[model samples]
Target chain A: MKRVRMRRLKVEKRTNPSAWTVFCISLVSILLAFVVIGFIFLGFGINPLEAYLEIIIETVGNSYGLSQIVWQSIPLLLCGVGLLLAFKTSFWNIGAEGQLLMGATAATWVALFSPLPEPFLIPAAFILGFAGGAVWGLLSTSLRSRFGINEVITTLMMNYIASNIVLYLIHGPWKGETMRGFAYTDQFPESVWLPTIGMSDIHWPTLLLGLFAAVCVFFILNRTRLGYEVKVVGQSPKAARYAGISYFKTIFYVMVISGGLAGLAGAGEVLGVHHMLRHSDQVSLGYGYTAIIVAWLARGNPLIVILTSLLFGAIYVAGDVLQLSFNLPFQIVNVFTGLILFFLISSDTLLKHKLSFRKGE
Target chain B: MKKAVLFALCLVFLLTGAIGLQAQDKLKVGFIYVGPIGDMGWTHAHEVARRIVEDTFPWVETVYQESVPEAKVEGVIDRMVRRERCAVVFTTSFGFWEGTVAAAKKYPDTIFAHCSGFMRAPNLATYMADFYQIYYLNGLMAGALTKSNKVGYVGAFPIPEVKRHINAFTMGVREVNPKAEVHVRWIEAWFDPAKAKEATNSLIDAGCDVFAFTEDSDTVVQVAAENRMPVFGHYSPMYNSAPDYVVSGQLVHWENFYLDFLSKVHAGYYTSKNLENVDYWDLLKEGSVEVGAKFGMPVNPKWKSRLGKTYDLVMERIAQMSDFQMVFDPFTGPIYSRKGAVVVPVGVRANYGHLLSLEYAVKGVVGSWPGEPK
Candidate 1:
């Protein structure tokens, strides 16, 4: 056999970029995204700067707008932080939307039908919501562990089933008598309603719970033995096996935690915002899907998920503001968010990989 | 580089402030929609009326947000009332009923007119065009044109408003062609274009030669036109989309209602004491709901003379009712459900309350409610 050596340019993985460098890269990428969206605004005969200014002013400047930002953030924060846990362990739980729906369904049932005392009702509803979501999450996780079915497909499919179940319930047995044949349930009693802070829409308990969950998840991922195991399993399953960590146990735990958090969001939304179960589309507005982007943007850091979720929430608030203020189409917000996510991913890739050129030998 | 970015951010803030100060003192009016204005259906009709309101009253400023979900309607209403200082806000969807009511309670000074909804508060009033009248007119045309004796209807949901329209349309169909049947397919969405198109194809396959829909899209009309089937548009005039197929449709002229309501406010008739009872349920007689004659009801040209006669009869009856010379109620006497049960006995007009929550499919209509077996 003739000896032959092939040589080509080799890609190399660089050391993790410094925090400051990463921050700067993110900032620049976001600015670039805005610039791109500004060009799109120009295409529509809108002054890009004026349009951008209107969004910022309407969504973040006034107190009501600020409260709306917070109200919108609660769901994203809960879902995004929960997703961080699952993504960290490489569980690929894409059924957060379905799980969230199940949670909302459970919470609504408790609020509407449960005979628990006023004090117990809210707490009990929250627990049941979490359990409903956890059970839904466990379905896909168990399927993946036992039958080796892909979690992504199962989770995504479950979303449709979950949404249909809600539709069926609203359209059938649980339909409110006074709704006049509309697809909505009766409002949750004021007893079960999450108390708002002052006259604002901010539900303090859920907001505090969301903040606490972020901190708790941050500790769990950084300072716990389970976190170590998750790191090992996510980095390499073979290494997890070598370290005597159970992949099945870790995956199950991560998904339950992830799904429980998302469920909490559903409960908060039902209790705090909607005060009733409506059509499934009206319930979540694709919060689960948006959280996926938030999780990716935060890079699995639970603490960062809070900031990123708030950013995404602001995007939503700003989207509505832009629509009302500038008469810009809703699709503009989608484009803006898409560009930001695209740039963020590209920057992350650029941070991790270094290019090299070598002569052929 | 960081300093430059900071400077740009500060500039953005300053520019926003500068623009924010350019607010006008006009009487601000806000509209909230459950679907996009480009839907060419329910929301589009309302947008057209919004434009008319803007054009008619130079002292009024109109702003609107489209495709707002029911869950977020409260916030949108709050913003419209608080941030935008809208004196009168119109929420143009049934799903927005509760939210509008809640906001009406919170902002007792701001007047709210909720369209296609039944709920009302002290500051909140309800307004809706009597769409069933036009549906009946369209059904008459469908009855004459449907060679297959099978007319298709794509319903959004099994809500009372839609059920009433279906019942009225069926009544018209049976009056003209007793043998004709109306087959209904519920798509469970208000504005899904693809699903509407699919429903149209399925109805065509099921031997329906004429079609009508309550969905918020032009897809059904487009599909019907493409397949050479006659159809009716929902909210706005959709003849431009399906010129060949469109016979006639329910044209909801909200401008008349809006002008009347706003004029009441302008004339100091909208005081808090009287606002609670201000429900404007207008029909063809009030010019709020019209047959699509203005859009040039082509009537298939083949069925023109026959459908034209029926149309003239409907118009004459409407005129008589408007002039208070006649009491011709569409839901009067001899109404029967599909199950062969008498819904409205002879010489008896159906109660308005009963009509509001009509749940059963009337005779000659071929579909059940959401949970019932098809």
Candidate 2:
């Protein structure tokens, strides 16, 4: 008879991981991502170290690059802060993208078609944008609460529907008469345009709003009774029920705030960046979807989202740098993003669970 | 350990950034492409032309960002101007018109040019290497080659630019085969290969034999040839993909405009403030567009024998188009819309403005045209 040896492995739930451990793990994951991407750079005949250096210098060291990062981060910060609330409530609201588009469409109506006077246009656009996104979110929430439908599928499907709505508008009644047969809208009036911080596309009104919203959300999540109920309902429905917290109500409010914030981002894109409601893709660039990564990376803390949003913003600017300077392919940047996210999620798993192996004789 | 990693990472970046920022004297020209450079159509043609521009001018250096969305156009232009110190930036694709216009306003000192757009600022110029003539030539060949008297067209979109090309092509086909119908199917996208293939198959199913297409990939050409049908290539020369079946194709020489524009910029003849009216609508006479299966060959030898009588007509048409003041044009009038209205009156050639905003389907076109006027 042959002797057989077995090695047993065990996984145990870790009660608590200190912030320091999480930071270290995140750092390790990021470094590991860079290492893998460095090999990818090598395959493309570019010096990986050189590529990293160029990205850093271009994004942080250069004024134009830094401004663009902040400009890009404004929407992300807004969306991420909103997503932080939704994630904390444990509602996987993937429809933020659709909500953002609907918000933009609503803002477009205010800017282009509204009879509002010049000075009132900007404020009205934001209000309409928020309402637009909130209403869109409510549709999904109602579906979830009434039919026990999964928000994930509904949210994702709504994105396509929202996109088609914009397409129909542009290709039909909203098509610009001055766009020379192209399917784009005429430039929004200058009064509706947001003021930018000199020479950069960093629209200050939206940026200030994002910072304000971040602080407000941070307070709401940490200081309020609703925050406590949200945590209870998300973590344990039975515990929440016993404690007299309504699951449906908590999720509904969270969905409203989340979708509204994303809508503000859409409004910002129209008023601040585009200054004209253009194609849906031209307005948002999937900032709402990317904000999921932003929120997750910040560990659902709205305050941390400020830093996380800027970091993702820098990564985007850096990707542009790699392509501009090194002639690197765009797919390589996508691979780089994929690696970071993969490692980050894996690290999260490691932080939550302890693994042990034993040799058996 | 975190601090140590941060420190090491910073050191690597600082050293590399320091080593990389050394300034060069070459006039950097940045290209903002709406599609990836690796693509086989419009972007690829421009990429190839950009390469030739780099080779032709010693003082010119080129950098480009591919797959840039229209939303990111201004941002890319900012980087190209502020970070990369690019003296000139060219925004390719029709969708980039408005963004390029806005960027042009922001950076008045930087010379800007937009392709296939009507909007032009004092600092922004517009240019297009249209394929109406080339398509007309290809249509003649398709008209001659199709036994079923039905030519299939896989269109990227039903936009005016495409409509203009199709009209000119149909005119050529009608000139050759009076009863030949040009069956068209719109993919509603500029660069989807699967859609192009399906559209091609759909046309084949509709009893059309010879094929022509305006898409970013060689899917239509490959698909048509797979079914042993003759097809015409668009944008870049795609003779290699289907040498036996390809009769002739529309080829762009974007380098001609790039070189001309850059040389003028290099010589200080064209300033940023003076480009308001610099619309480069260069055709065959300016060597901006070519009619050929490849660079040198006007028609595939294999297909030339098959084109038979219309082979001479195609050659004659090219000769007429390539002339400085050409006598003949495919759109030489007495042309009627498929709806029985005369689009072009007797002996009146379609002028530039009318051609640019075309929205009519010519006779023998068998598909729905969106945005058609009554």
Candidate 3:
């Protein structure tokens, strides 16, 4: 009893982190990111506390600002949820931007040229948008499945072609007669325009659609048999094949769902936000690309994507706030966002392992 | 759980109270830009004017969001009007036309002015400098200085605004040196330096000794300087960037118009109700559009007299307008399209409607439309 044996401690990896540990790690990572960004604020001759306060006051403090945050989050939510499904299946679909554009183009065509009634036109636009995006998504899936081509290259290249198609249409046949030779199409009729809630920019229908999509995706990935097959194929393709899962069919289905979701985002942007098809930059604003970061930060969780997308949306609103209040350049917002993402990814390693001191063996 | 709920409620109250304290009595003026303010080109020019506005009006507070995409302009406008309480908003991009118009309709109490566009409403007024006047002067210098007789123009887009500039420059080139031809290239972007440099090099390879560009960077001037060729700057002065190659270029002076417009707003002469049908297409006569230099011309020392004479002629013609006689109009008659059809007949000066909607290249231009065969 008097001679107590000395015990040795060891650092070891955890097969899985507890929910409480995951939550604490995320909070700590975000706090550490803010501390680092505070140093940047000081370097810019701005008080860190004041800068953060201004961002909060401008973005989430008022109803108008909150509406803007929600407005910006709609596209991100759709794209992020879509990418969540694609990444879950281990199908690297980098053509969300191209798919988004094709969807907007299709929706715009239906809104402007379709002879359908007001009641039918809106639904038809959504359907056509989904079809357009699905086709674009299938292009890369087919190339990957049929020819074993890397999807990253084909998808990235498709973005340019899709953008050029929009440019050609706006500059040629679809150009508005009264636009004075501008590079934009005519506005959609009021009937096709997504009705907003009260006077705010909150397009409730699209917002509800985004929320519904996240729930549906979560159910598909967690509760459905197809989801079980997808997880198996993603984890171990050889085992999935032994279990009689067709790799081709899984890839096709996942790509279709992913592309369809992105296409719906495009339709929302055109019908709900811009009310017309303009330049690719104006329509998407790199939301499709930004969704990649959103999906990764959410760890492929469709439910988590809602919060992550709103976080990014807050960052965008903060950018405008920084410009308006601090008189800072827009690039400062980029640096801030880049720092947050950097810290979040770096802290990911902490979730898998814990450091402990070891006594002499 | 009760403690957590109480803490959340307290935090919300604190945030709302803190936000309420930020209201001020200052008259906020908001600006929306389509490009970065540090581009040293179009946005920079507007930023410079904004500085003047800030310095001139002590009571007015200025706020701006740069690189606001065209589609998102309406949202920014709404934020400015509703959240920031901005009474007057300036959207400084042609692509923001639709958003500005829609915002004007939505916020009838706020005054909206769109730059480089043609749409106007009761609360929405449009303003633009007569850039073609300066481009024509630059063309005169390019025409007189070039030895290869092949000039190059790197345009940003096929829009009517840019098309008019290209046509005017061609007219100036052919006016002095009839043999000089202006070859055109479209980069399809306004601010891509790499593409601008590539386009400039391609034109240089195509035997263009003198160059003019409508892009939003100094890449063309830098490329021409590297090659020891002559070029003209667009939007801002590029003499410091390329001392040897840049002879003369268009320098947009938005300060005069901005000061004038803001003064009117401050004086209560220009408001939402009176702003309808108000379009400020300021020309060289109004001092809104001028030669590059602050007081006089920024003509290169070598060609000062030759270019100075044309500048004097333009000013003289403006003065002579009070007497109802037009002498040195850039779009004056006998203008021919690239297809050999006379677009502006002899003894007829092109009016604002025709110039604003220019669709075809002039006879001396050596490029076709986007879908046309070269």
lDDT of 2 by residue, B146-251 (tens): 8999999988776788998988888888889999999999886788999999999999999999999899999999999899999888887789998888778999
lDDT per residue for candidate 1 within A1-361, as digits (tens), equals 8756666776789797777777888889999999998898888888987787677667776777788888888888999999888888887878889999999999998999987877898998899999999999999989998999999899999999999999999999899887877789987778788999787889878898889999999999899998888888988988999889999999888888889988999999899888889899999999999999988788767898888988998989988887877677777678879999999988877678766776555
* TM-score ranking, best first: 3, 1, 2
Cα lDDT listed for each candidate? 0.84, 0.87, 0.83
lDDT of 3 by residue, B1-374 (tens): 99997996688678656654564566678999999998968899999899888898887878888998887788788777766778889999988887898888899988889997877888888898878877887787788877899999999888888889998888888877899999999988889999999999989999999999999899998999899888887888788887766787887779888888888988889988887777888776666765552225456665555454565654454454323343467888888888887889998999888887778788888975653212
Off by over 4 Å in 1: A1-13, A354-361, B1-24, B293-302, B306-326, B371-374
Off by over 4 Å in 2: A1-13, A223-226, A238-247, A354-361, B1-24
Question: How does model 3 fare in lDDT?
Answer: 0.83
Best by lDDT: 2
- Chain A TM-scores for all candidates read 0.93, 0.93, 0.95
Model 1 interface CAPRI class: medium
lDDT of 1 at B125: 87
Model with the higher TM-score, candidate 2 or 3: 3
Looking at model 1, the pairs that clash are none
What docking class should model 2 receive? Answer: acceptable
Model 2 chain B weakest lDDT span, ten residues long:
B16-25
